[model samples]
Target: MSLNRRQFTKLMVGGMASSLLPSSVLAQGTTKNNIKAIAFDGFPIFDPRPIFGLSNTLFPQQGKQLAQLWFSKIFGYTWLRTAGNHYKNFYAVIEDALIFSAESLKINLSPNDKRMLMEAWLNLKVWPDVKAALLQFKKNNIRLAFLSNFTEEMLRRNAKNSGIDDMFEFYLSTDKVQAYKPSPLAYQMGVDAFGLPKENIAFTAFAGWDAIGAKWFGYPTVWVNRLGKPIEKMGIAPDSTGKNLNQLVDFVLT
Candidate 1:
């Protein structure tokens, strides 16, 4: 049940159109204020390209390969550890993945290179539309929090660096449950943090798989498809999909 990129996109575009149909035809008269809280995946707000760029600088010839493998391995390690009932914080998973990626690619990763790459996560810049959207949420008195796999330290550093540290009330990490996303326990962190019914909160997802996860957790999910990636073929679709945070605000605040 695997789909090529093109096929997946065609399905996604079809699903997107259906998902975006007028509210009267969908969730009839769903009010904007019905949503009281928003749980955001960290990458939707903070851009991660600079970290890949740093990897490229360190490994000129194998940079793209290294970056791709490193990113994949990071999640792979997380999932494997979770399934095995073994737990490690996101930071440790990332470091292990990077080391494995370097070894697999036969590149000599210097201490400086490793340190610089790991440190880049702390210095991420927010996506261009992030601050404005956050302000709109604030104006509307919407509760906002980050529900992500990132450690609190990682989220704090990046939020402070991007000047959005004060925008979020809760900085939730799966570390509390010792599980990664798509795991019900991980999504429960948001539910527990907000103390609101799942239907009253919107989960903003940076990836399609996450959208499915949140939907499964019973939140109205909105996928911020910033990369224009194909939607996953899971049986469930997000309640909505958008290209940026501005669209996200519209989806949540309608």
Candidate 2:
């Protein structure tokens, strides 16, 4: 293919720029980075798929729909409570969402079923890619913490279940500020706990909206798009995005 003079100059400049970065940095983008600490949203670290699997096991007919609605309602309540100043803890919000989902689907959820479903959240394991990435982060001296909307009790219980509780240096639950994410106060927990600038503290978000929230608060954010979802049309984007923790490790440690 032939190139116009302007196109040729652009290609030449791009080539020169690409040469200056490490291979991983080239993929993450051209921006120079200073990410010293990473603040992770809980779902990215703990595999929540098992909870959905249990829903399927309990209600074979309505399980898929129930799980989707319940998942959506969980975040819906968080945003609603934040806006209305109702301020329910995440665990309560989750239980409320589950009940609403079951009732809406006309599924008669037994007390034992409900108990088992909620308990699943407390016994989650990390995703397959999580341990290697976490070990690398620890090796690199990159400080780590949880910046989740989950209550500290929830986060701690899940971490303990995964056998990785000691991996986190802090748990910056939004419970402390009584605010869910997208609020500046909620994101500020990372900066305060890490005692680092928002730019230096990278936030790993499990959902697109949460990634936008962290970016809006000035954190260089990475959206771990584990479900292969598209980015939200929020007029903002994460600095990097990946399907799992391994890609996140490259973006940060590169």
Candidate 3:
């Protein structure tokens, strides 16, 4: 089911309000505080194959299949209904698909296969743009952090991989909150942890749905498009949109 141009435009417009709320509302609720910190999705910004590369050695057949499935799922290929909606991680949503795809092919992933995949997760590579962008933010005195759905160990490894671990004042995972994004609790916990109000923080993400959630929570939002796609159907436009982290820095620092 491919969306035609009309359908795509409708999707983008219908969700524009949620993605980009009126500036009046934002101003009414806005405080004078500068952005205190930043949060990002680790895997989407970085290449994830190396982590999954190790998955191949343990499961051999199954591992290779799951790795490919994960990539296809995240990179905009169509798949069957996933359990969670936009809030689920690319990997979690595909776990079921991977299992089903494997079973249909009569492949069974052993426990060791799973463990090895988990190990692969710790070694994700940061996108080339990430380090320079974070350094720019740090130079401007904005606190930086990661708020992700990954577990503590996974987040740490991602930090090491990105080489921006030192820039992050805190590394938050969904395990600590027991919920995912679009859940006010998750975003709230992020705001509370930094002891800042929503208006004071700028939530940066490539995910349009996540940006919508952050906007609904009253944070100034920036969408890093990376690709020049229309904003998702989130009923609001981001406060600003950018092609990369450097663009985001320009938006924020300006």
Candidate 4:
């Protein structure tokens, strides 16, 4: 019997709970491409809330405003730099964004405040389910790597802090290509690192735009929609969408 998408998702989740899913459920609705490696966007693996919370604590009244502006500027600076052929590393872009954000918000950011906020990225904690899902991927011998706009130092520090440093095979940074996501060169890093067809590397994205970027780059893509945001109006959609890493595992493994 054929199952609709919602029914199929229910069955898959139930099977996961019981530690056994029907083969039909596993095979149904999954991508035809044989995914050999999984490349993850940074946000899906590292929780950024603590950094934002710290911003709030430091600024009190302006914390949320500062966080919002800083976050927006992070991507804005990267894209503008990439488009203008002006390349700085992701860490530099982030620091620039923070300064811009503080200035825009008219918040006097102290040197100590800047140091504390920047250090937060290095000290990020992984999402609660990340360890178990990563363990399963390792057990299955699936190659895993971080395909992110974060600098390699940022990725390494957080992974080591979270005790998952050994989980990944590649620490791909857009700095290598001197570009940012949705940039074809940035996405190509995953294909180059895995030495596999784009179809065989599943790109797991934490944001809708990243999912669209990976899809545009020809990988089978999964969007881990932790924020429950609506799909973008982009012409393409992801191969799958899930609420968290466990659901991402279901899409890739099952």
The whole-model lDDT of each prediction reads 0.89, 0.89, 0.66, 0.90
lDDT of 2 by residue, 1-254 (tens): 99999999999999898898776455335424767789999999999999989999999988989999999999999999999999998988999999998998899999999999999887888888887888888876778999999889989998888688999999889999999998999999999999999988889999999999999999999999999999999898999999998778777777
Stretches of candidate 4 off by over 4 Å are 1-33
Q: TM-score for candidate 1, please give it.
A: 0.87
Displacement of residue 34 (Cα, Å) in model 4 is 1.3
For model 1, where is the 10-residue window of minimal lDDT?
Answer: 24-33
Residue-wise C-alpha lDDT for candidate 1, range 36-70, written one tens digit per residue: 88999999999999988988888899998999999
Better of 2 and 3 by TM-score: 2
Clashes of 3: 13
Q: What's the number of clashes in each of the models? A: 0, 0, 13, 0
What's the CA error at residue 115 for candidate 4, in Å?
Answer: 0.7
Supply the TM-score for candidate 2: 0.87
- The digit string of per-residue lDDT tens for model 3 on 113-206 reads 5555645666677778887888776766677767765666677777777666677888777656656666676678668778877776788776
True lDDT of residue 63, candidate 3: 68
